[model samples]
Target: MELKNKDNNSNSGNKQINAMTEGNPVRLILVFAFPMLVGNVFQQLYNMVDSIVVGNYVGKIALAAVGTGFPLIFMMASLFIGLGIGATILIAQYVGAGDIENVKKTCQTIYTAMILGAIPISILGLFLCEPILNLINTPADTLPMAKQYMMIIFAGLLGAIGYNMNTGILQGFGDSKSSLLFLVIATGINIALDLLFVVVFGWGVAGVAIATIIAQAFSWIFGLVYMRKKYEVLNFQILKFYFNRDIFVKILKLGLPTGIQQMLFSIGIMSIQSLVNSYGSDFIAGFNAANKIDMFAFMPIQSFSNAVTTYTGQNIGAGRMDRVHSGTVAAVTMSVIVCLLALVIIPLGPPLLGLFNSDSAVIESGMIYLKNVMPLYVLLAIVFVINAVVRGAGESVVPMIGAIVTLWLGRIPSAYYIAYNFGKEYMFYSYGIGWFFWLMITGPYYLSGKWKTKSQKLIRQ
Candidate 1:
């Protein structure tokens, strides 16, 4: 298996994305993960800005109104997002093995699928918005604004979906830096527009939604142009769409389980959201703000986990199982170190929550959630990085099963039981409980070495 030096081809003028098959595992993983971490932070800002602007200008009800729509949006997008992850995994493997031809085919297949799928998703989402909100028992005071914000967002779903697909495609190439650039563009635009629409023009929730969609649209289109110009393999002709049946089948096999997992995860969050809603608008706003802050603690590990996936994929494709194992160790170690940041974040909870809204009830409610979940963040870090390694090895189903066991069987049910019997304040404990279960499931499977054999059939394809 003589490998090509294609990933570092200077003559090809496409060395923008580095190959992970060479270099020190720890250093390479760190270098790859850093840009992605920065990008993830900026990406999180889109929502953070929305929350900040809406909570300050339009009031608490409006803040809750915007916050209430997130789970539905994520739920709606989860399937496609899963497919994107599948595409990323495939691309990383192809990049690792220097399979440039198949990488192009994957790009074509997933892009065509997303474009065709976005149409029906947007229309169907519009019709389902109010009904789903009602089903979730969204607070009455927040319902109208939530519905308005969501419908507008659904109409612009293509922008968000497209930009994310772009990220996934680039990520598969092990090109985290370019994705960071695109996110920076989107985040800057979002912040500027958030101020303009929500505060300056006083458009409220609708304004924030509109700004997000517009920013996403711009970033997606800009990324497309950049990729077309920079990477020969990814120079997809937008109008000249091609759907490779074989590639589509392969992607479906890898993506469907992950898609189901993501959908269930979103459903689990939505379930907790409904419980939060029952406590009133202030609690909902608080939970939303706290959740945003939680992402900052989680972001570094999440970035490393994503890097682990690519690291594992490339090394597996290169038939370097030893490097894959070493990479996993490096990634887990990095993640644990990063998770200690939660200690700092927990003590600063009140100040952080105050960034969204000045209300004492909101801040107090947020503190309850941070205290419950932050200390146990290490459990999630281990689970996530380990599962990423498994998934990158083309073993998607195992991670999907872990998600099912964690979210559906563990977290959601535990949240409901505690909220009903004990109190809503105790419900956030369900997250740590779920992460423990996830670690329990993931750690054993990795130790068993079962995942190494899990996806050979797909890889051989």
Candidate 2:
């Protein structure tokens, strides 16, 4: 049963939610994405701090240990993240349509689902921690620490899930700034705790993990208070839980494919991680450090992509196909421009890698990875922007199919073959290859106008 809204304010009266259904597409997308971009950067910074503190203080092995667990953690959390994506789209649509009640229901539904879903995922992750590490061929020296780190992360899975779901809800409402503020709080707390725990207390990998979860839990709690006070529509009692079956089903239908895509993508990365692990802990740490550097290059485009998702969702919900197209162009252009700007990172790779770890071999390995990947970021930008536009229009299955084709056919197999036959240095080229294939899929789909029709159906349904 759908719950009744006791509040009398209509969607427009709820000033907290921005209506992207109007305004200039470029300006709106830029405005919307900036906070999200900063937030992503902060999130990545804390992640880098994790690597830096561990690599510098604990050892290269600890860096590799944390790195090894990341793909596995993401794989486990992917489903809920997907559901959050679904809820964001639903809420965006409802907000656009002035269906404030459904918007509230979506926020409530996804929150409840995330809280409930975290339990089994936590248990499963705990049980599989060691076994999964073994399966991934984690370096024996790193495995125990990796297992410990992962177990702590899993045990506090609700914090991460809840925090992300909270961000998704805010993003849906076109309120990206609040999410950024939350991330700022988390990042500050996390960095301080990381130094205090690992550097001061000598807790090693365990300290970093504990600091991370505490920060996330704190951020999630702060978001709740912030949202409740700032937005009446978002004010809901956490203790009183309910699920609107129809909204959940809608979320599941949209989110399941994206979840599967995330799982497959994570699995592909895990396979690549195993191959890197075969080279031992130094290479793993280098790869991890390089990945962090790469995210800085990638984050702007990614932020624009996310911005367009909400942009396209809200515009399409308002029956503005033209705005969707214009937004896509604006987002794509902005992303490519940022990608070009980010190419500056390639020349600075060695120093960047050195910041994470002082070892020469680690720096060399990271530079090799960076040189191979950074130049081709324009392709990734195009792929991500177009893909987000498709997803925003509620055509998630196509993007999922793109992931399957790209990963199975383009990235993973190519990575293994190139690494084994040519050399490990060539493995990063597979990222560009996969991204090219993704663009091939999503670009054509976007041009076909099929996604707009699908969006209409989704909105109507």
Candidate 3:
């Protein structure tokens, strides 16, 4: 096969980027991942602002309410999101292979699935909100607020579903720049509305929910308009979409494991959150604040991991498996460089924690949590990038199994046992311990070169 250049695939005027299928592996991956990195920063701010505004303007209890509801929200969102990940990988392969018709059909099929899937899930999600929160052992004082916050957010399920699908579409095509632009637009709106609704009007927790829903609405609308202007291939007729078993099976084969994996991952986080709730509101508030900050620090690794997916998927689709090893090396190098930024940022943990709340105890407790986890970020980066590489090779089960073991067997149990017998600080240590376990499992598998053959059997099936 001849090595293809970006000009062949990219639209005129360079409105879209085509990094993964061509260019120097290191530079291509970095340039491709940069927009995703920035977009994720703004996206993380969606959660970060919820805590900051609610904490400062309303109270710690309000902040705790927002915190308490997070894992639950993700638990619901990750189900569809897991499927979206499968769609992204498949689309990347189709795009790289230059199978234009299949790409169009797959995108329409996904939108069909989204439209059908969103209705029942939203209904089920809305109905089960309080019961699930109760099952998680949400504190009595915070129960009403958690219920309120969750209900408002889930009510806009269509918007959230639409927005994520749009982002995944751009991601599959190697157009991270357009996605970043929409996210910046959404984030600006979100922050402005958060201040107006929460601070000026005093709507409290509900204001945060309204702002997020509205921001997501903007993102989805903007994404649709962008796709219309730039990518002619993706603008398929939705009305003509019919269920094709082969395409559906192709997507589900890769998607289900990841969906289940993400759902289970959320369950694991919720499990640990339940344990955290047992420690009382201060611990919950502190952990919540600290968790928000921790997400910002970790987004780069997560962003680069997505790069590994697109990079690996496209190269494999193009029959350029030879490029993968060097690309993986580039990803790891970039991830390490990003994670090392924590060393400078973590030491000022006190003043940083002060941004959320003035309470000395909240700051101290949050600092301890951040200190334990932030410096060890590089370990998670290694694990994330490798799993992404393997998964993108069309073997999603490998990472799914790793997530099950790490989250269920290692992290959750350790967090529970440590918090119960030892104390809160020891529970924070469970994260590093779990990442080490994940690295041990996935690292050697990547080195063995067995996944290449395994993916051949899977992808062709």
TM-score of each: 0.96, 0.97, 0.94
lDDT of 2 at 322: 79
Residue 347 error, candidate 2, Å = 1.2
- Give, for candidate 2, the lowest lDDT window spanning 10 residues: 1-10
Residue 13 lDDT (model 2): 40
Off by over 4 Å in 2: 1-13
In terms of lDDT, the best-performing candidate is 2
TM-score of 3: 0.94
Candidate 1 residue lDDT tens string, 330-389? 988888888885678888999989999999999999998998888889899888999899
Superposition-based RMSD of candidate 3 using all C-alpha atoms, in angstroms: 2.8
Off by over 4 Å in 3: 1-19, 237-241, 454-461
Backbone steric clashes in candidate 1, count = 0
Strongest candidate by TM-score: 2
Error of 3 at 215 (Å): 1.2
Off by over 4 Å in 1: 1-13
Quality of model 1 by C-alpha lDDT: 0.87
Ranking by lDDT: 2, 1, 3
Q: How well does model 2 score by local distance difference test?
A: 0.88
